[model samples]
Target: MQDPVEIGPYPRKPPVTIVDWAMLVLAIVSVIYLAWITFWHVSDDIHRTIVYVDYGVCAIFAIEFCWRWRREGWGWRFPVRNWYEVLGMIPVTNPAFRGFRLLRIVVVLARLGRAADRAVGDRVTAAVVNKFVNTIVDVIKRPITVAMLDEVADVLQHGRYTTNIANALEENRAELDAMILERIRKDPQAGRLKFVPFHDDIVRIATDTTFRIVFQVLEDPRTDELVSDLVRENLDQIKESVREKDIVRRPGATR
Candidate 1:
């Protein structure tokens, strides 16, 4: 058999660029300016100036959001998740909702935090989070039965799953066939057997005998009935065992 191939580590995402940092700083400054103008009453001229600055900042954020949305395969979920950015873009004169523009700072910081986590190898934090999530899943998970598994498998095998598996197998059939042939050729006994006199005849005879035995067994009238009876008996035993266990575990059951 061929040795297993060693896969290299996944390529790391490119680090945050200089332009990203500049944009983040600009966003933070704009948010601070917007907050000041909204909460503390400024002169009409100053308020108008800050409002214009806010509009410019909002435009920059809108462009950035669109770029990211496109980069992420044009998914609508991006805007759905980052609703604060959308809210910030809406022109509202009310100072109460004007603070929504500050949410843009939160979004920027959150993105920076995630980038930092990725940059710094945060495997321990990831492991801890994974363990916590797994614990919760384990607590909520239900026990599975063979019959349940069989039903699920049947549904999947009869549906798209079977088609997908068939397509994959068909695609790789040539490679799989080549691998099998290579393995057979590399077998230590294969070369010795080839040199044996009447080796091909012996192989054919052995194969025929095996096939005849299998055919006879399958053709026997009792074979199907015997197998069915055995399976039914085992199922009955399993059911009885489960009932006994349930009775023993009952709240008021006697020891």
Candidate 2:
């Protein structure tokens, strides 16, 4: 991650760049002025000036509210758009609930402090990207690997198997075609064995194997259903690959 920029130890003033000193003095003076106007003033002229000043402060705060709204992307609706912003404009709402509005100002100040701290700490996006990449690597290189291969095998086998119980018995289907083919070629039931394929057995093995392999790797509901469908499809293929046995064994009988 890129390092954060530091901005601290505000250098001591050697007259402190007149502009800096001016801003500091103005801020302190404004606080003292507001205190006097709010608590001690009784003159009409002073009252009118305080009203104008309050409007000015309200304008500055409005601009800040707009800026923060944009910064948050203005992507979704919020329950409340800052009480201070509401108080600054809505007379009835403000007077009726000024204390609540004031608390919002405290929250806004706290948020600004947090933002400043983050600005001096580190880049947040870089860490998020790194964590995302790590998780992807872990999933693809570990348990997901085993599930993927088993899916391939299931697809190849389901083409030869039965899809339902009625189809298994009444249709006279070859459930274990691939397995039986391999066994037949190896045992060469030439004239001795009776080979009858069992659809139930073939479907059972393929379904069980596929479920065991994929259940742990997938989490999304849609993906889970897809995996199950794929396994069933593969079991159907295996049913179609069966053949009968030789001699003493009728035509197709499988162990």
User: Highest TM-score, which number?
Assistant: 1
For residues 1-255, could you state the per-residue lDDT of candidate 2 as single tens digits? 989966333222332345334433433443444445434635777656655665554455455456556766764442142432343332211233333433434333333322232343322323443569666464444334344445566564444332343244334324544454456446655313334376446545765565445443343455546656777666444433322112224336445
**Candidate 2 CA-lDDT value:** 0.43
Q: Which ten residues in a row have the lowest lDDT in candidate 2?
A: 239-248
TM-score per candidate, chains pooled: 0.33, 0.24
Best by lDDT: 1
Per model, how many backbone clashes are there?
0, 31
- The residue-by-residue lDDT of candidate 1 on 95-159, one tens digit each, is 54454544434444333333343454333333444669666444433223444434444443334
TM-score of 1: 0.33
| Runs off by more than 4 Å, candidate 1 | 1-15, 91-255
